[model samples]
Target: MDELARRSFVAAVLGAVFFGGPAVAQNTTAGGVTRVALKGYDPVSYFTDGVPQQGSAEFTFAFDDTTYWFKSAEHRTTFAADPEHYAPQFDGFCAVLLSRGRKVEADPEAWTINNGKLYVFSGKRGVLSFNERPIDIAQRAGENLKQLR
Candidate 1:
């Protein structure tokens, strides 16, 4: 098959195996629409406010079929300018789990900004584990991500 077709086939297979639903569900919860990204927490606020601020549906944007809410028009504009810079690492998956070559749901409230990258954890333990060695865990997760991607 052609390269494009082969890649599409592989992506489809991976999406089915990993997500068990539409590929867009990788960003949302079970491919549902009401499930907002980062659990409705403003992505920009994590940096600008140094905390997780709940966002409103009024200021929102949809990317990759997942909705991202913002606290204000300014924050929404900032996120629109460059979402990759503000979005949670590993697509909001538990960073510590990813470091161990696993995929687990993350708790938006349990997170940290390390080296300008936002990492969410499944719980307090995952946060502490990731904190123990951010660089090392990041390296390990990077290695795993290569194969997964």
Candidate 2:
């Protein structure tokens, strides 16, 4: 195989084995669970109601190999209009864990929206640590996500 093709093949294999699937597989984590981003929470609610509202499968949209639930057709439309703007950072994985270069399940109830970005936590500890140093941790998490994506 040619060098470029070989490099791409190797990268694809390594990414799938180490980081789930392709870089667009941001909805998934390293643990191999094709996690539904925000865990069925209504992404629009965070902006509209300022809370994490449970979403219904009836109002859903599929993106990046993951299904996102919404509270209403309006919410679904809103999300579909601009998923990147609404989707959680690091595919809804714990922001704190991402900062530490780890992938873990997130607790929907434990969330934060910093500068129009949604970030969820795996647990209370994640929330605490993220809150303690949000800027630095978020920066590190952003860098880590760049590599993952």
List TM-scores for all candidates, in order: 0.69, 0.70
- Model 2 per-residue lDDT tens digits across residues 16-116: 53454432223454687655778889978988899999998676665544667788877876776666688887767789988888877688889888888
The ten-residue window of minimal lDDT in model 2 covers 17-26
Please name the candidate that would achieve the greatest lDDT relative to the true structure: 2
Candidate 2 off by > 4 Å: 1-34, 146-149
What is the lDDT, from 0 to 100, of the residue 130 in candidate 2?
Answer: 82
lDDT of 2: 0.74
Full-model lDDT for every candidate: 0.73, 0.74
- Model 1 poorest 10 in a row by lDDT: 20-29
Estimate the TM-score for candidate 1: 0.69
Tens digit of per-residue lDDT, candidate 1, span 92-120: 77778888899776888999998898988
At residue 38, candidate 2 shows an lDDT of 80
